[model samples]
Target: LAPQPKAPPSPPAPQALELPPNASPVLSSGPSPPPAPKASQPPPSGPSPPTAPKAAPPPPPPSKSGGPLPPPPALPGSSKTRPPPLMKSGNKTDTDEDSSEAKTKLKPFFWDKVATNANKSMVWDHLKAGSFQLSEDAIETLFGCNADKKSGDAKKDIASKEAAQVVRILDPKKAQNLAISLKALSVSAEEVSCAVKEGNELPSDLIQTLIRWVPSTDEELRLRLYTGELSQLGPAEQFLKAIFDIPYIYERLDALLFMAGLPEETSNVKQSFATLEMACEELKNSRLFLKLLEAVLKTGNRMNVGTFRGGAQAFKLDTLLKLSDVKGTDGKITLLHFVVQEMIHSEGVRSARAAKEQTGSVSSVDNNDLIEEEYKQLGLQAVSSLGDELQNVRNAAILDADQLAMSVASVVHRLGKTKEFLNTSMKSLDEDSGFHRKLVHFVEQSQTDVTFLLEEEKKIRSLVKSTVDYFHGRTGKDEGLRLFVVVRDFLAMLDKVCNEVKEASKVTPKKTKTEFPHTQVFSRSPA
Candidate 1:
């Protein structure tokens, strides 16, 4: 701490007076002075006679207590004269001194005492407990004047108030202690430099933690201008000052952290792109999925026969999710259920034909039992597996295009910053300097990797846009990500329908055959 200026001396106490034996009793000290003597009446009508001068009074002796005597009381009589007021020794008046004494007598605030004794952890513990509240005056005295100016609200919670005070005051030791308690690394700047030069990676967590505790501009300036012994400063200040010797320290740390994470980030982005590609392929090429959509279109056209919606050629993918909302006359089976049933019968018939062709068998079955049993088994197997066939679409549905783009952008931005540091801040370094050489190589390699990533990102984004357009017909600006979501939801409804169909097939008697009256509206063609 800097040395504080000394306070001025207090004025001496007033002492008791020792009056002479012949002195009048009224001359004793009192709050008010006595009246002064009036002039003698002028001698009547003639030249005044010269009067002899009276002898001067003798000096009064000092009191036995060996202190100066108080001023004598005024003589009786003419006009009263008041004594001069006591002079103040400094800017502080007597009342100010009394207040200072009172403050000194009061117990110190808990945090203030903790700071003085260097029990920083205890201070934090007490603060975290939040068992005590501080007055505005206590905050000013403990931290500094106007510490609350940042918040402007006096009703802020204790933790925030104390944190704001600590930040504003710039107590290096306290900051360092808090950092250490919070698991900051104890390694010195030279250790870090040596580690980097030796081609060894620093702990990723260590770099992350230290990056947060980097000194602010004002703190850095204060450290640079400090004229005191380095030993006198706290470890935080010393470490910060030492790191100042390493050019582009912050940039280097940031680059190292970025490089450490780049591989995983790139892998994630690649996986997302792959999922998107698979989702698009599944939507465009899955035969059974296309057939299911054809059935939906035929059904919808039949329902809207007399309206303007009749004979519609296509519909948005989002309508697939709404099939469950249209219930049958029985109020149990949904339109999705109807579609699943039709697809099942179609798949079962096709499978039966394929099986018949492969086996070259022709078995005659007059009874409906054999026919119903045979087709039901094949249809349920085909419809139940649709969810598994479009697994990539399910995965892709959870992804956000903008978030992925931002992640790639973040990597590129960090690489750009690293490159800028290498070019600008390390210009003075010789070509042979290990620090400069290593960082330059890192930046160059990173830029190359990021360039590849940017190209991949652009390619994937374009693919996603084209895929959205293929399905949705020119999606809104924000609709690229929504395509997979809509499909994913439709797939969920399809799964529910498949489950219901399988359950229904099990319960229905072999004698009873399931019929689709709605299928009569469309031609019995492949779609």
Candidate 2:
């Protein structure tokens, strides 16, 4: 009965309200929107209102007017510069620190950092700063220290020996080939590294060899080993530590080696410079020899005047070979004999004139007869004088021009190498240090010297070519042989003629046969 009474009062049953076509559902005041569908129900199929993607939770409300919130305070013990986290390849979460660390690990080796002898000087400086311990095996391996020796500075002696070896290795002048020695050192270092990695001790002899070859001090060697940058060098750090344990020992040894290397290099540079200068002087002071060439050219022009190929501005030096082809009616005599004869005759005229002046007396003797006697006496002497004047020319022309040029080039090359050595080696020294300043000065001076030498070499080369061309020497074909060989053969022929003249002068002249008066008169009347 109570339910019936409540049902009578029950409100009209709720019904769905339809919106007019022109009325918006929002504007239409309809029963409150049907209770939102339960979460488990699907959304209605009819076109639903478009929804935006959920925005990132609105940034925390600004804490101040018109300004964004400040960053949250760091937690206790948190660093502002956090260490980078480890990352896998292709990881998107990697931080800059991680990227930088990866790049560092992937960096390639720079052999130039340690390969140069200059770096060894830097190593010495580091060693002087402190003492470090060396393992027993290292001492035996590098310094050849006897394992049984537990007393009496035996280690010191071994270190001294090793130091000596290092000096010899670093000084290029001591090595037959500097490049080869350096290469061998690099290979040995690699071998030592491999042996160490294999857990086998490097051969003592090999270690000794390396120690001898390596310019770096034992301390630097140890430090490099510790860093593993020299990983391939096997227990190098240990060996270095053992050898340089004594305080100030490596310092002294480094100084000694540096001083030792200096003298040899200095001497080599000086000697090379001296050689170049001497060669340059010889070329510059060869004026007399050049005049001799001019004289020869003049003589040749006069002999060939008015003929084809005559009055030549230049003569092929090879023409000297032809001088012997022209002989007198006497088959034994050649043009060289005539040339010598003329030279002797000229010398006699001068000699007789000088004698007359000295005597202040005019002898009743015919000057012509006196000149002939003088010619006989001066023949050998004139030949000797000619030889003396020709000696310089012969020396200049006979030298192996190619060899001399090559020697000059070699000196220049060596000088360049020495300059590079000084520049690189002195870099480790303080700019204000005496050695550094000295090296810089030497290098500068050497540069000037080298420039001057190069200029002189150019001049010499030009002179030699001009001389060859002036001689009317052989042209295109056999030109090289013509320059020297022709002149050399000519000088040889001249000497032979002088010898012949000397022998003739030693002999008595044969008397001429006299014709009877009738026979002589009849011979003259006919022709």
Judging by TM-score against the true structure, name the best candidate. 1
Predictions in order: lDDT = 0.69, 0.47
With candidate 1 superimposed using the best TM-score fit, by how many Å does residue 54's alpha carbon deviate from the native?
69
TM-scores for the candidates: 0.62, 0.39
Report the C-alpha lDDT of model 1 over 172-210, residue by residue, as the tens digit: 565666357334566776887775554357788777766
| Candidate that would win on lDDT | 1
